[model samples]
Target: MKRDLELLKVILSKVEQQPQGAPFITNKDFSTRDPSLVAAHIQLLCDKHYVIAAQNGDDKWSISRITFDGYDYLDLLRESTLT
Candidate 1:
């Protein structure tokens, strides 16, 4: 599947909104989008070091927190939306 930048932003925003160290489980969250799609993007995020995630036995990812790079990217995304 193609990369969805908007979904990436949404995922980062959701992860950022969570309390520090809180785990954002892919299967439990993001009901509005396809589970597989979300999982794929989350894997991409983890691969890019944008977020710290752990893979569960069920093949779903749990995001613990956003990295500094993640925050930087998110900020840029938010800024772009303002224009």
Candidate 2:
């Protein structure tokens, strides 16, 4: 779960540096070998209101943006890790 959260943080940071609604491709370099687990992580993010995920009919996913709550959560995580 910790690794998943870290991966999500990385993904969010990358998306933040890009334009709004920019398409993000999930690949070997961008995700874990277990995509099903990653999908679960995304679902949790959505439930927590941290991010919004869109899935096309063909099953492609793109993150729209991160909410303020997401940033706050990540910041708290970072502080804990540093301490």
Candidate 3:
């Protein structure tokens, strides 16, 4: 599936706002969005090293946090898209 840049930004922002080392739970946080899409986007971000995603202890839900690279990427997007 193609990357959803908008959703990616939302996820990144959420992670950034969260306390350090705290995971942003995907399901709980992205309640209004399509779960599969969110998961796919989070996976894509993780694959690109823009975010860290972790799922443990048999929990079906995964959590993520923005990485330094994610901030850089978000900044680049902001700069490039600004009028």
Clashing pairs in 1: none
Q: Model 3, range 1-83, lDDT digits (tens) per residue?
A: 77777887777777778886674566457888887777777777778888777744332346566778999987776566531
For residues 1-83, write the lDDT of model 1, one tens digit per residue: 99988888999999888886665656459888988788888889989899988888554878888899999989888788642
The order of the candidates by lDDT, greatest first, is: 1, 3, 2
lDDT of 2: 0.61
Per-residue error for 26 in candidate 3, Å, reads: 2.0
**Would you estimate the TM-scores of all the predictions?**
0.85, 0.64, 0.76
**Number of the top-ranking candidate, with TM-score as the measure:** 1
Candidate closest to the true structure, highest lDDT:
1
Show the lowest summed lDDT stretch of 10 residues, model 2.
24-33
lDDT of each: 0.83, 0.61, 0.72
Go through the candidates in order and give the C-alpha RMSD of each one to the true structure. Answer: 2.4, 3.6, 3.3
Assess candidate 1 and give its lDDT.
0.83
- Clash-forming residue pairs, model 2: none
User: Between 1 and 2, whose lDDT is larger?
Assistant: 1
Clashes of each: 0, 0, 0
The digit string of per-residue lDDT tens for model 2 on 1-83 reads: 45465766665566556676666644223554466555556666778988767664343455677789877876765666642
